[model samples]
Target: MTTETSVDVTRIPRITHDEATAITAVENRKFGEQLRSLGPDDWIASTDCERWDVRAMAAHVVGGAAGQISPREFVRQVRTGRPIVREIGAKHWWDGMNEVQVRERSDVSTDELIAEWDTNSEKARIARNKLPKPIGRLPLLNLPEPVGRQPLTYLFDMGFTRDVWAHRMDIAAATGHPMDLDATHDGRIIADIVAEWAGYFDEPFTLELTGPAGGTFTSGSGGETVRIDALEFMMILAERTEGTGLLQHTLPL
Candidate 1:
């Protein structure tokens, strides 16, 4: 695997607006399909997310989509959720927002949840893609260390899609749902992740990631070499599993 041609991390281009929009739409549809296929048992299954079952995970996805449908909706969620998060002793406002999301939809039936996801995900795609360039370039918030601050475009283009993709993996693990990975779509996302990971750590290493979405990536030379499954690597980066050494550094999902 190491013998495969190495991709220069610096050369990997940022995902363009069109690519981001397309990927987000595809991911949303796939997630909705996965939700629709869940059975009663699957809905209640425990996932890698410590506090969430499959149902709660789905609710979070729906809530995230709803918030992204409009700037007004997004602000409303932040305003309503930040105080609640502080009350709950959570460090991040998003934790409160996620909690509120799950609580609001706790009583929603499985079918209704699926329906809402379908509607809101579509609306989110439209709203995000329609964001004016000037607004998108503005910094959204100041995040913690490693991720000091991010622009609105980061959320629209990468953050939200990565969040849903990571959670989709979570749902699949809990329910044994077959993931529909392909070289084209999933591969693109994985490659982008590799680029970010390599750039963030900025050390010498060779990564041999196996599976349809996998590839060989290298940065500098003579660094630690790691071989792992592509999806599992992503799971680690998303902090769903413990990692060691270089892998311990993570990118926000």
Candidate 2:
């Protein structure tokens, strides 16, 4: 006989709409700054996402922001992404949407890419924050496997922010650029991730994550003790690097 365990969603700390908005606003600005800092050669640098160079990653980020700017744009992306998803044999429509985003921007200059990202990200932030409550409460379309189903607000608020943040880390790793990290913003984001990760197992553990964005976390009583670099722990949860024991479980960035 076998049994399976699942995350207790209720146990995870919730990020409210207001907090989500603030976090994303900061994250988007930081991401843009990182993009602008990239040298010409850095644009061609390989990231952890094997198929994408830094430019492609930035394009995808811009596309994500653009899609969020309005319902029309989001629908268009979904409609246009269908065929590409099929052609690429991708398991999800988002994969196709990402491809479309990258392909459409392939000819764009690095400067143009950064500019577009800046504009679209700002627009995206406003649109998301102003989204109708009814719509925000609705479930998302084609939710990714690791994340499962979540409200539309989840994508607009936390999901997109996390994606940009993770990509920033990827770019930094690829090009040796220093990340601007602090206790307030990055630490809060990491704490939320920790809460969710701890809930995923629904087990007791003590985790001490080190670095500016890191903190000590515990779930239930002591079951296991773990200590690791904060960013590296995120890498493990994101599956950019293999994890062992409890760390083997993954959550999409």
Candidate 3:
């Protein structure tokens, strides 16, 4: 989770709707392909996401999308908090969902898991398209403070898209497979992250990230400057690495 900082929701710049949709498509294809290339040993590998393994992380991605498309059931689960798993320490809505998703898919084969992800990723993309513009302007509930109050557009564009991309990075790192990231598509993702990360601080600062996703960015007024590799900057944002100065302010991926 990122440090919570109040931001004017209206002032935030989002990738265009098309870009958001494209992100979903491209991320899914890449993620699916990466999974396909992994073996059974890789599926059980641990990731940076605390207790979740590769399969569990992938299950959350697919289950999240499945929940979106199945409103009646999803709403029921939210309302009643049914099928809760106390044994796994399911303390929150997402935690419970993550547990359920992994449990439900426990018997599923690796190939099936990859196929299901491809299907659900597409569904998540389509579901985003069907949302009313007015709905996009509404605040998302129960998100981390500051970020929690942001509009649905921010959640879809910044939150959801980044979740998959971050997890893709997680899987690649855990499996020792080189992850594929491009300048245009991946740069857009990193830039959005930088913009939000910038919003967390009161003083001015400059960030210089050098690599495929690298770029120059300014936040607030004149203050300290930090230079880092683009991937390392992301590692800081994802809280995978400790940072100094304004870099210490973590942002949700």
Candidate 4:
């Protein structure tokens, strides 16, 4: 995580490398456990990602284990600001990890899914730990300017936490299973995402979140803005959805 030495972070607490590592481990295990849950026939069913299914999501989880970051030589080429991955086509880049999954695990037994999870979890933990501390978040610099500098690292940290829960819903929705969240992952993500809505929206809008569990919502400081319990809201931020909704509920300053 990046540190702004000058900023007083009383409101936005930063998560450490170790914390990131642990969360990655948690996500990996959760994905495996969920995948292991399926009957053989369920692999081809639809998933939240639109074009993919349970199997494809499994492929993505495993592919995440592959060299997720660009190599040193490539990163060097991207020095000064341009992202190395940005130079490549989305399909081509995704293919790199796809290659890893197919090459390394083509023969992986269903029973070994959790073991693969453990392997990738450790690999991701070590790799993230070895990297330099973040200069800024936004793991990928996709947006155009100002907001591009948004706290993506926090988004990523929050994403993983949210992913485990959301994807559990994804899995559950696909397979008709029950949903339950561990307190650790649930609270952190809910907090960060709530704050993220406050930070992202231009208006001093207040949110009214309504989900299956209950109904109570978060409002920004000075009654800025509000976020409803729209799964679409979470999916859009997760990049699982293409566009945004109700971004500005009120007039801005």
Candidate 5:
């Protein structure tokens, strides 16, 4: 419920390249399996995100998984967050999203969509792998959020990890598919992103978290106790699930 713009995030935690890559692989497998589980007809059905049917969603999900090269403008947006930047890719990225999107009509069989998705997803991964080493560290976003003058690597990791979890929700919402409880990158990237926002924006929210076993835990709240399920707490922070889901659960926050 809190949406303030000026936060002091100088103290937020950081993630290493090793951890991000490991978590991504874990989430991707869970999501890929979930996608593979769908019957041919199910992929063609409509979902909560309007204008994108299951097939389109599937393609978008897979396509989305493939990360983009960080543009100079994108870097600026993330750090300063002054003006919102539209997501863009290498030349014709627009055409692919708009023109190509229009060309792939529902009449296109689910099998075809699935095949294109498989192919494009591989392409996307290859594209990501080709980026510079520093960029590899960034979280991937379906639409990269703007942060000014800083490296896009941070945003990329945050966006990719969050999208992985969010899309799993999308699949579940659309098909009643059960979510892989351990599907996400343990919300590490998201937690960092939320923590960043907590500093970057003026939001009066406190996240009480349980870190990986034996992992250090820290918050800006001076170690005061706040009750909440770590995942639910993280979800609200990520703005994916309304904290309303926690009404029944005795959340510490």
Candidate 6:
């Protein structure tokens, strides 16, 4: 495995607002359907995420969507030291924001949460596409990897897209329901995630994800190989799996 702390900022590709918006729409639609299918009891069931139940996890996902258009909250979140600023401080920031989001939405019905997600996700999509001059080009500091500052496009495209996907899986696992993952749609997002993961480590490793989202990738010298189901691989990145080597190095998204 390659040991490198610096990420090649130039190597990072740019994503158009149109692409990000499209992906966001897909994630929101499926996520909305899943929320609607939940019974009252299922909403309160516990998820793999500690201290977070089905309802709380949903709130967190909705909060992430809502946060995209909420500049004020973003500022406050940064003040509280979000992970993109310092990965080490991420746990506290994540817990604090999640608690606030869940508590504030406690009185909201599941239907309302779903509606709000749709609304905010659209707003975020518009905002991302129409970001004014300098703002769109501004460097993003909130990232799990300490590679370097990235542009706003990267955050909205890679970060938020994967965030929604990961949480969708969380809810599914918690409620014992299967995800509606489509190879083409979900595959695009997961593929981008794999590309990003490749840039993080210089050590040669091979990853083969087996499922509709399955694919093969090589990083560094491609010496060590990891074979896993697509969903389980994502779970591992979410820190829900235990193993050695790359499995221990959690991806930021």
Best by TM-score: 1
Name the better of 3 and 4 by lDDT: 3
**Tens digits of per-residue lDDT for model 6 on 1-253?**
1112322323334445677678778887888888889999889998887778989889887876666677887656545544443433335466566565666788999889988986787787666566665776788556556346787767765567777788889888888888888766786676666666666666667777777766666665536788888889888777776758866766756
Candidates 1 and 5: which is better by TM-score? Answer: 1
Query: lDDT of each prediction vs. the true structure?
Result: 0.85, 0.81, 0.73, 0.49, 0.48, 0.71
Which tens-of-lDDT digit does each residue in 1-253 have in candidate 2? 0012222224546778898888888998899899888898999999888689889999999988888888898788888998998887788778888888899899989999998987789888898888788988998645655567788888877988999999898888889887878878887788787776666566677677778877777666757778888888888888899988768778888
What order do candidates take by lDDT, descending? 1, 2, 3, 6, 4, 5
Clashes of each: 0, 0, 1, 10, 33, 7
Displacement of the residue 116 alpha carbon in candidate 6, Å: 2.0
Instruction: Report the number of the highest-lDDT candidate.
Output: 1
TM-score of 6: 0.82
Q: Record all residue pairs in model 2 with backbone atoms less than 3 Å apart, i.e. clashing.
A: none
Give the winner by TM-score: 4 or 5: 4
Sort by TM-score, best first: what order? 1, 2, 3, 6, 4, 5
The model with the greater TM-score, 2 or 3, is 2
Q: How well does candidate 2 match the true structure in TM-score terms? A: 0.91
Q: Which stretches of candidate 1 lie over 4 Å from their true place?
A: 1-4
TM-score (C-alpha) between model 3 and the true structure: 0.85
lDDT per residue as tens, model 5, 60-173: 555443324334422432333222123333232332443233233446665665565555544443444456776654544233232434455653444455565665666666
User: What TM-scores do the predictions have?
Assistant: 0.94, 0.91, 0.85, 0.62, 0.56, 0.82
Candidate 4 lDDT for residue 154:
42
Error of 3 at 104 (Å): 1.1
Candidate 4, residues 16-77, lDDT tens digits: the string is 65576676666666666677778877776787665456666665555454433334522333
